[model samples]
Target: SKTVSTILVTGGSSGIGKCIAIECYRQGAFITLVARNEEKLLQAKKEVEKCAINDKQVVLCISVDVSSDYSQVESVIKQAQEKLGPVDMLVNCAGTSMSGKFEEVEVDRFKKLMEVNYLGSVYPTRAVITTMKERRMGRIMFVSSQAGQIGLFGYTAYSPSKFALRGLAESLQMEIKPYNIYVTVAYPPDTDTPGLAEENKTKPLETRLISETSGVCQPEQVAKIVVRDAIVTMGLFRTIALFYLGSFDSIVRRCMIQREQSKAADKRE
Candidate 1:
């Protein structure tokens, strides 16, 4: 029932972001996909236009590195607003995995995850929230992971960033409630995406073993449910997928993470 005439999806060239962009077009939302890869963005734009229900709902692609600075993200948001009108929806989906023990992983790897995963979500939300607040309507969704809800082994650089996202969304939900803006944070199961496939190969054997123990869902499937929940129910159904993730405490604590190094050890364990 909710209508998003103009939407922005970060990391829209691949994985869940690309699928979300396509689904938004199917639902009649004009989309601007932001990512660093111009070639992929162009290809994704074509695919979205092909599935678009309303040709009038324009699909635009802008190349921007979400992991960089806030200023870059803000500029992209400003451009999207001027070109496509105010952003009715914002989806934060750009992220990467760094596999290794926390001590073995480089500091830069952790920093990269924080910038792209946590700050990637933060910068865009900051850029658009003012307008959404002024207009008194908007939808903000974060494509967090099941690992974020629980924890995954060898997710040294990845899990903290996603966990940070949950904290960010929880705080923002209360702050934005008065403005009639909705914030939905999703924790999807391991998704079958190119990125995940690559990680499965390069990551240590332990990482692959742990991933098999849990189920993996298709990106398109997760995207469909995410879009349906974000648009139709707003923030009401945010924790549904994440709730099941909480059941794996042992996996979160013993196999996946170092017991001595855990941050939210008591809460998750």
Candidate 2:
């Protein structure tokens, strides 16, 4: 019977972020959607406005790269707060993914992921944490990926950035718990989103094969269950991961053999 009064979501222009906004909007929360693209933000605002349950509900859109400048992120967040009232919930969903063999991935790509995935979450959290502490209550959510849990083939550049979110969540929880603020870190599986489709285009054969073994989930499906993933499943989850690691190893071996054979054939010509 309780409802969050104001919800601010970065990367809410698309993917799981937008869906989360819609779900919360249905509960009558005032919504603010932040992303880098102005067109997409407006489009997302229209889609989210459809789920409004009360005439009082409002959807605001702000376009700014969450990872670019801390001051800029803080400024936009302040503007959003001024318009929508203090943010009751801050969702850090703005992140990017790139995949390739460790040695093949451009060195710059690793730094880019850290900026988008780690600092993107940090800037917004930094901007709002102070106010949340002053108010003595709020919820902060980080949307990480399954890759965050176990490093996999071709995720050499992407996994660590996602993994960093868990560390941030764990440390932030301890500091904020005393103020009655809670942090939630969601490790969602391969989701069917534009981001995933783009990532697939560049994924290594090994990564793609491993991904097929664990299909994909729709955004709405993910948005529904991640809220409950707070349950302690680490013990069993790690055991299962080891089994998958064995399968992943075989997949990588198979791809290596195929690539070597193709290279040898080219030499004969």
Candidate 3:
């Protein structure tokens, strides 16, 4: 059984974040569910509470945008610690995605995605890290996406935001290793989540095609894998993950060929 006692998860109101909270609760850990929606946070707290193995475990909910203001994030984290004890693990799971061809996507969305996906994670991690280092024990998980590891045809805006997490995870691990705080970056397969549903409305055909190569995964499955990995150690890309990347490359190449042939036919007309 996992030994960590308290965990704080940004974006814990739904999807993979909620599922991760549930899994940890089942293992008898106190949980802090953070999100921007008070309603959703309450709903998630109820769900996570149902999974507790011991009556002593507590579930706390806080509504705040992790990406908005650093001071606000820091304040909320301090409150959480005062109530539940220092964070044993921090999960940076709050992120947003907008998918379209580079030209078709509004320039402003690029900044929004970066603010939500990159800086959103940075704020929470920064708030908790000082305490983690002082305690000499902690685990941090960055919930990156498969797109984080591989650039696809229509993910010009989204991929880069996700990719930034890898840099954060790797570099943070190097500095924190001596303190016994492990940092893990997870490239979870495209999962069935509310965030993904919103992105699909604007997702481009080429990006959808490449994403389909790996098929969509369930958020619960992703949470299980990621939570397990986060506890074990910092790791590199697994062999199976590399194989999926190879498959995605073929899809991108096929889309490129189709676009060229379509252009040739139009010119002939």
State the C-alpha lDDT per candidate.
0.83, 0.85, 0.87
Top-scoring candidate (TM-score): 3
- Please give, for residues 127-209, the per-residue lDDT of candidate 1 as tens digits: 99999988989999998887787777798789999999988887677666656788888888778888888777668778778
Question: Tens digits of per-residue lDDT for model 3 on 50-157?
Answer: 887877889999999998899999999999999999999999999887788889889998999899999999999999999998898999999888889998888889
After superposition on all C-alphas, the RMSD of every candidate to the true structure, in Å, is 11.6, 17.2, 15.8
Error of 3 at 90 (Å): 0.2
Worst 10 residues of 2 by lDDT: 230-239
lDDT of 2 by residue, 187-227 (tens): 88889999999998988999999988888999988876754
Higher-lDDT candidate of 1 and 2: 2
Clashes in predicted model 3: 0
Q: List the residue pairs that clash in candidate 2.
A: none
Backbone atom clashes (below 3 Å) for every candidate = 1, 0, 0
Off by over 4 Å in 2: 1-4, 227-269
Colliding residue pairs in candidate 3: none
The TM-score obtained by model 3 is: 0.86
Model 1, runs deviating above 4 Å:
1-4, 236-269
Q: Rank the candidates by lDDT, best first.
A: 3, 2, 1
